[model samples]
Target: MRVDLHPFAGIGWPGRERCGPMRRCLPQLRDSRVGIFGVGSALAPHVSRQLDLLPALVPALEHGSPRERLARRIFDNACIDERRFCIPDFRHGTRKVLYDTLHPGLGRRMAVYRREAPRLAASACEPALKSARVAADEITHLVVVTCTGIFTPGPDVELAERLSLQSDVERTIVGFMGCSGAFHGMRVARRAALERNARVLLVCVELCSLHQRDEAGAGALVAQSIFADGATAVVLGAIRDHDRTLALLGEDRTCLEPGTRAALTWEMRDDGFAVRLSPELPSLVEGRVARFVTPLLDGIDPQVRPAWIVHPGGAAILRAVQRGLGLERDDLASAWSVLRRLGNTSSSAVLYVLEEALARLAVGAEGVMLGFGPGLTFEALRFQRGPGV
Candidate 1:
């Protein structure tokens, strides 16, 4: 279904007439009062223009080889216009010529991540806090999620300092969960928002560029073609008076397509992490997503057909999910927009899609946010647009 990103976009349900009657009639919407007040996302300054990627990949490909042709074809067909990067050289520089000589070890990559990830996280979070009218000191818990980079005094610790959050604020960092990692963080914030006097801040940041490798294999080429750096922040709390936000409804998490574990995997190597994406992943998802997502929506009220906010892991994944769910292309417009504009920002991607979806949502509108990661895992959360400011 097509979703419009505007204040007066969807069918309106005035005042308590929105959730009050629906909650009683449909138990699924009964207790969903927690809301997301604001969402902010930021891309790094270094951008790879639309035509820059193919030329950059050309030098990496082996001359006069079939594999090289395949690599070029993959990059050409990735459906990405441009992508921002945390590493300057990955953008418009001579890095292509020096790529073979540059072997950034794990230590070097970690150094860059430790120095930059928090800055990007804070940049995204500050505006969210301001937009929500939430003071840094007022936030009781902080949740940071990432799988791209790891270093102590992690982004969580540094963000608390950078954002000037309270000294005793509770903090949690979710690591190595790949793209769906932010869903785990959102789940944490969802629980925190349920507590009295608690305001939650969730930050998702990924410096996928720092993990770039010189390998020209299919997996590496796929990783290089799609991954980019980005950060997003979300403010969540129990619904308050006059709050214009999206309600935090129930969530469902599951591991699907067993024995397909080798289809997608991410592991740490000496020179950054490695990604192995089997060619079968897209078709596997296409075949299984319907069964996987159907149960998540089964118990919800049939009248509240939630809009879909899917993680655009790649163009293929988006197409796979759309067919699996019997949805039209417009249903995934936000996802496609984010992927074309920013590529896959790993864990921060779903948050970007959510931000866009919420922007277009009208009061009492419902939506579903889905993300996939390692373990062939799927994280799905149901949300409803609540009252306006």
Candidate 2:
């Protein structure tokens, strides 16, 4: 199912009347009312390692082996210089090796997640609340997004306790959506803020490092070379007078490209969650992104050139989107910066780019964020800087 939400203009759902011209929609809010008030991010505590050390760090890529050679090539071309991990063994030698046999049981991995995810998530959320100038008791809703790990009495419950949020704060979790998960969480947060006039706290945290496997195959190698661990949080609410927030301008209909379900897949296995990335995925994005983005662009004023916040799934995916949309390299600088420094943090990756873009966006500037996930699904959120800074 696809959803096109432009609250200030009007919403477009299947079987509903399509949104009219901007002139007809402009008076609904006088100006955008709902928006992102603040953003904060945190990385796993372990120090990062350069790409060159990965073979030595991961046992699956033993020196002088075929996998090691393949990994080196992929890492060199990945455009990533360093990546962090929650597991200290990735950067420092430890007798208790996590991926000793390339097959750590799912139970073992999840145990690590249950212990660490909440701490990292809380670290991110605290600063987000501080930056938004909203106290813990003021949050009316909580939304958490993740694809890396799961447990009952999950991170959502722990986050509230760690942050001292009220016991009655509404909570929701968006899981297993892969890289596009943040957009899905934002969609939910937008609804809560608009429908209930709520102050929503959205947290996206991924422990991708825990899923690294020593399995053989180009797909596994590529995934290993580019995935990392990180968390990001954003506070959403009604834009106040003279606020310098990123207003929710609109959201385009989400599209699932046909016949591409296998292009990207994240599955849970006896060992742990595994990611399979088809080499053809980049080309698929290049072929479809323009058509996917056209309708959303048509809804906006033609004179405005919106900034592009495409997810940096990898260098290839970023280039594909840039080529498809006729965008310049500078258009995606924020994405590339994140990819180079942190690798792909899966669900939290796009928000890192959004945090960077927030610092550079001029008052009244507009931008679009795009994310892709397991279903070969593409999601888009349109936003603009509110009037006063």
Candidate 3:
């Protein structure tokens, strides 16, 4: 709350003499991998009505067999039907039926980076970096995170070299952490800072839509429609004084419905990626969310501010989040804006929500960044603003 809560917390810090408290907090943050921002990419097959999922889910529908009956039952009662998703189909003809969406080849990946990385760097990370920039030879550690491709030479190395980061600067790559990977990366960065007193840079890039599947059933379509791609890069540094606009606030997390793993699944295949989404998902969230999340929000004030920065999995998913969290329509405006502008960007979506929350919501207010994936589980982090957080 000192970093986030106390600001609007109705409890102001008593003095500029924060040395004792900051010392206690600084060491804890040293290697905590505790915080960050989000980046995202667009969905592949580009979410069009021209493509169809009804045919894919009920392949033998035209044959009129018992399988069709089973398919009907599955579709009628499943999340797909209830969610009103049109399988968010694709437009590729050659790639259609062969796979969901095209995985980026090296050339294609470079093409995306060409247009995206520069603009993103200029717009997001660069501003933060510029805010925190210092004389040369100061930055000591860098952490790059992503989960959407294959490459031995990897984007991290390419990014560092391109940016002219110090040649000997310590660099690390975090891969395959999934939607919650950035948090996982923060864990790693926190450790690095704690051990070496290293200044760290966390970069997130996920072209989520690149992993979309084409001829899959409703599950794949739904997941792909809601998941887009983008990148986020931020610098977390240590400062003796509180003059810096940004500061780390306390953070807490939890998992839910551990047994519900079958609710959502993501796996790679020769045809791209296959996902199985169950209709029981929203209900799972509705039932368990309050129990799981409320505890996480236990000490926070809900009356003055109960804002939420939920990863917008999709339009329906947002609806589920609102109902589950017991929030009114206006509580998650930032989340909706990101979802409307950029689909779910996996791990980065939460970061995008955080960015939105920081920019749009009142400072020092409490908010939750929540997401759910294959675990059929929920992951949430409670946060208040950092200094200028």
lDDT of 2 by residue, 1-389 (tens): 45453322122333222222222232222365678887899988775656655654456556788778877787789899888777776765564457665567989999999998999999999888887878999999999999999998988999999998999999999999999999899888888887565899999999998886667577777787788899999999876566666555564457777789999999998878878999999998887776565555544555566877878899999998877777778889999999999999999999999888888888767778888998899887777765422
Across 1-389, the per-residue lDDT of candidate 1 in tens digits comes to 22222221122223222112122233365466777887788879778864576555345666658977777678778888899977667555455322444676888788888888998999999988987888999999999999988877778889998999999899999888888898888878888888898999999999887776768777777877888899999888887666666555654545544667888899999977888888888887776665455544545556555688899899889988877676778889999999999999999998889888777888777777888888787667766776643
Best by TM-score: 2
Could you tell me which residue pairs clash in candidate 2?
A: none
Q: Which 10-residue window of candidate 1 scores lowest in summed lDDT?
A: 15-24
lDDT of 3 by residue, 67-185 (tens): 54444544433222111111232332534422233343444544554444434433345544654554224557778777665565666566666566788878777766577666666
Which stretches of candidate 1 lie above 4 Å from their native place? 1-27, 55-58, 63-65, 94-100, 299-305
TM-score of each: 0.87, 0.89, 0.69
| lDDT agreement with native, every candidate | 0.77, 0.80, 0.54
Q: What TM-score would candidate 3 get against the native? A: 0.69
Q: In every candidate, how many clashes are there?
A: 2, 0, 21
In model 1, what are the clashing residue pairs, if there are any?
A: 5-360, 6-360
Better of 2 and 3 by lDDT: 2
